[model samples]
Target: MRRFHIALAVADLQDSIADYSRRLGVEPTAVVPRKYALFRTDQLNFSINQMPERAGQLRHLGFEDDAASGFSSTHDVNGIEWELFSPADQDAKIPEVYGKEVIRAG
Candidate 1:
């Protein structure tokens, strides 16, 4: 089954990890390059990463499901719309910032 994920840019990995750990009651599953980390849960994958140089402000939000059938439903919601990476196909170039498998919807 597919799982939803959220990636956030943080300035301090350790502080963020500690705060999130105390708040969420879980530690990260992976830590890469001292600037990236991931926390997994039964229904969500939360990640933190360093922002790229010269990148403008960015915020991405989307959903994941075993099948690519909920985009339209979620899109119709009042404050949501089509994100750049939703309904990602097998051949889609998953962004480096994500650092996770983009499971194809069955």
Candidate 2:
């Protein structure tokens, strides 16, 4: 099964971790204070990092698929970014995947 991944940056790591844990009803799967924390549930995979520049902001969006082969990133008209990992032969719907053009591995 493919899982969506969300990564964020926060000013306060521990506090954010605690807050998310409470909200998600579970503890973080892994944490490295002042560095990062990771959480993975059946429905989602999340991570928060202590990056001063992007604090309190989303770092990126990703898709984890065991069958995926390469990667791509794009932005919508609203400017939200997304990254997808998929096999080359797989059919990727552009409009739905957040891109106006087909992105290839560089």
TM-score (C-alpha) between model 1 and the true structure: 0.51
- Candidate 1 clash pair list: none
- TM-scores of all candidate predictions against the true structure: 0.51, 0.64
Q: Candidate 1, residues 25-98: lDDT per residue as tens digits?
A: 77776666556666656676566666655222223445455466323333535654433223343123333444
Show model 1 residue runs off by greater than 4 Å.
52-58, 63-106
Angstrom error of the Cα, residue 60, model 1: value is 2.3
lDDT of 2 by residue, 21-95 (tens): 998877876565566766767777677887878887888887756686667688867787876664232234322
Candidate achieving the largest TM-score: 2
Model 2 quality (TM-score): 0.64
Name the regions of candidate 2 deviating beyond 4 angstroms.
Answer: 70-81, 85-106
Worst 10 residues of 1 by lDDT: 82-91
lDDT of each: 0.54, 0.68
